[model samples]
Target: MQECLGFYAWQGNWERLFGASFPQTTDQAGVAPLLSRVPVVWFSFDEAGNMTTQNAYANRPKGWEKMVDACRGRGIAVDMTVAYLDGPKLEKILADDSITDRIIAGIEREVALFDGVNIDLEGLGSKSVHQADSRTLVRYNFNRFLNKLRDRLQRLNKRLYVCVHPLNGWFLGYDYREIARLSDGLVVMAYHYGPTPEPYEPVEQSVTLALASGVPQEKLILGILTLKPYEIPETLAEKVGIAQKHRIGGIALWKISFLNEDFQAVLRRLLQIK
Candidate 1:
């Protein structure tokens, strides 16, 4: 199967994603070089579970459409991520049946502008205290929401991707097996443990655990962080090798703005990006 290399570009880092020039010290002219190798780019410009308001894409950066069109022109898939900081909004939406249509309408409107959607519902893990019945309710409602969203995307002929934090499903209360089954794929966020970053051990363990949890390797996408002050080119390279060795679906980097010359060089060499 073909291996996918993906990257995330947040709203704050729109300059790096579409900027014409980059720091010369980074040995990079612009984002063009990186786009050649990356098949998918996830843009986190939409607020999570806030579909009641006007479409977020309407406020996108100037030339946003041109940028997306440029990406598409290169055979790259531009996906938007809908992320929730906490579970209350998501929980509230899941609790109410009447808002489902509105949510679906908002998503459809946004999906029409992109290749697909990535559902990133954070802060809903099992770390919090909840009664057995409440937990079951949350899980059921969340699953229902996903199923509905998946159905909508299917009807539109668009892809649906989900994000899985570093935590295990048992702790997060997310059914990864079912999530993998419901969406096009799952992005396993394997970074952001703490200030003092370790080598590739944490990522390897996370990937291994995800696989053990019944998430198919083929449906898994390993997510790595590219924040500064975490110099571990060798470790990052090793992780890429691991992903390839395991034959997982792909490898996704956290953000494009943090990428420097060294980092870009490493990625270009390992991923063989022209």
Candidate 2:
């Protein structure tokens, strides 16, 4: 099967464009080469849970439209990423039916403008809810929200993508199998295990946990961080080999802003992009 490669780009990381000589210019040509290699790109223009706001996309940075258009022009899917907001606010939002509907509707409006939506909610059960009943309630509410969102996306014919952070202390909250079944795919964040040193054990454990939780290999996209202390070419190759060996969905890099020419070339070769 063909592999799917994705890249995540944050709106705040506009230093390159803002510092460039011609900030007004769209510079589609500058990004075309990188866009050509990835099948999916998730853009975060708003803050966590900001999708519920009316002007969520109003403050989109310069060249945002041009970049999204370029991705679409190449048959690539652009997904709007929304992170989770912790605290009582998140609990209240998930528990309240009316609030949940409003949030989902707001998200749908944004999804209409993009190819899909990516939910990057993290730290599900990290809060101090000691009682077992309270924990169960929290999990139920979260799952309910996901189910409602999935159904709404299906009705709108939009893809639902979610990110599964590595199995750490925060793993108890999420039900990976349920999440996998409710969405198009899961981006398994396999990096950031420690102050990197080319460790593959974390990646392996993540994949194993995801599979054991009933997430099919085809729906699991291994995520790699491209920031400094980057993986050596050999380690990168090993990760790609692992994905290929397991017939996983594909691989995704954490951010495009940190990718350099040398690393990009390595990705192009590993991902088999022409």
Candidate maximizing lDDT: 1
The runs of at least 3 residues in candidate 1 whose Cα sits more than 4 Å from the true structure, single-residue gaps closed, are 1-28, 31-59, 131-133, 168-171
lDDT of each: 0.65, 0.63
Note the clash tally of each candidate: 2, 0
User: What TM-score does candidate 2 get on C-alpha atoms?
Assistant: 0.79
Pairs that collide in candidate 2 are none
lDDT (tens digit, per residue) of candidate 1 on 1-274: 2444445443444445554532111223545546522323333223333453224222244445666676676667777666554565566666776665566667788778777887766656455666567767777777888898899899889888787776533346566778888988888877666554546677788888778878888888887776655546766777777788778888777667676667777877877875
Cα lDDT for residue 153, model 1? 92
Per-residue error (Å), model 1, residue 3? 5.0
Residue 142 lDDT, candidate 1, scale 0-100: 72
| Residue 233 of model 1, lDDT score | 72
For candidate 1, what is the lDDT? 0.65
What lDDT score goes with residue 118 in model 1?
A: 76
TM-score of 1: 0.81
Worst 10 residues of 2 by lDDT: 36-45
